[model samples]
Target: MNQPGEDFYCDEALSGRTPVTVVAETADVLAFEHTRPFWPVHVVVVPKRHVPSLTDLGEADEALLGRVLAVVRQVAADVEREHGACRVLTNLGRYQDSKHLHFHVCSGAPRHPDTD
Candidate 1:
């Protein structure tokens, strides 16, 4: 039950309101299976803290971003290894449903038609 235009990661997942099946986790990042997956093998990597968007990062967020990307890399590698191929992506601006900086590591065809 995520609200539109809200930061699902910070407001739900990070806050422990929404339970997530963790794929990988680090000191500053969390990679988990998407609550509502768009692809067959879909995982999301996000920073523990609330960063508005990828483009909104400041100097203080560099280390955190690096950690987040590192987790994303590992998760993407795991998905690609098991699924043969995978896509790693992040949305920005109006394309982003949630105002949290998160990356999708996914493989296979879209589960929902509207996702494509």
Candidate 2:
């Protein structure tokens, strides 16, 4: 179960409290399979360091964000190649569940009705 206010990527995934199947990794970024997937094929890419949200970036975060996106691009490309189609997205403000900057690379129909 997830808490109401928590940075799942930083507190669980990046901290290694929750083991994840990594798809790609870098010094500043990590991409892995979603623990609880909302789609048939779902991958999550995030900065290893906590950055509250996309709009919360600072000047120093630009490079890290680029690295994160590079990983997202690779993961999305792989998913698209394997599944024929893919979607890359990120939630912000009220739409974000976890308070961490992350992007979803997914393919195929959503597995859950509540997927956003």
Candidate 3:
């Protein structure tokens, strides 16, 4: 279970409130290890500049979205290379605990087998 703080990805990871193990990053995007990984291999990707959610994207967000997707593609490729399969996901609405726009790249077994 990834016990993310009350802060969203922006306030936690981007603003440096929470230290993160960075996987990849560009001036406008970042991919880092999940704070508390649910899966054996879990990583989080987000735009350095805050975008609220997927539905909130605009034409001005295209460039940043491209950069974020590029990073997600690379990370997913790496995960699938080792695990044989990987899942990329983005949650919206009530499912989204954090309001920040982000992607999840994950694979393998659960980190904590005890949890459902």
lDDT string for model 2 (1-116, tens) is: 33544788878999899999999998988999999998889899998887888998743367788888888888988888899999999999889999889999988877866555
* Cα distance off (Å), candidate 2, residue 65: 0.9
lDDT of 3 by residue, 16-83 (tens): 88899999988888999998888889999998876767888633367788889999999999999988
lDDT of 2: 0.86
Q: Which candidate ranks first by lDDT, i.e. highest?
A: 1
Candidates ranked by lDDT: 1, 2, 3
TM-score of each: 0.89, 0.89, 0.86
Report the Cα lDDT for residue 79, model 2: 88
Q: Residues 1-116, candidate 1: write the lDDT tens digits.
A: 23553888988899999999999998789999999898999999998877878998733368888889889889988888898999999999989989888999999988966655
Report the candidate with higher lDDT, 1 versus 2: 1
Better of 2 and 3 by TM-score: 2
- Runs off by more than 4 Å, candidate 1: 1-5, 113-116
User: Least accurate stretch of 10 residues (summed lDDT) in model 1?
Assistant: 1-10
What lDDT does the true structure give each of the candidates? 0.87, 0.86, 0.84
In candidate 1, list every pair of residues with a backbone clash: none
Q: Model 1 RMSD to the real structure?
A: 3.5
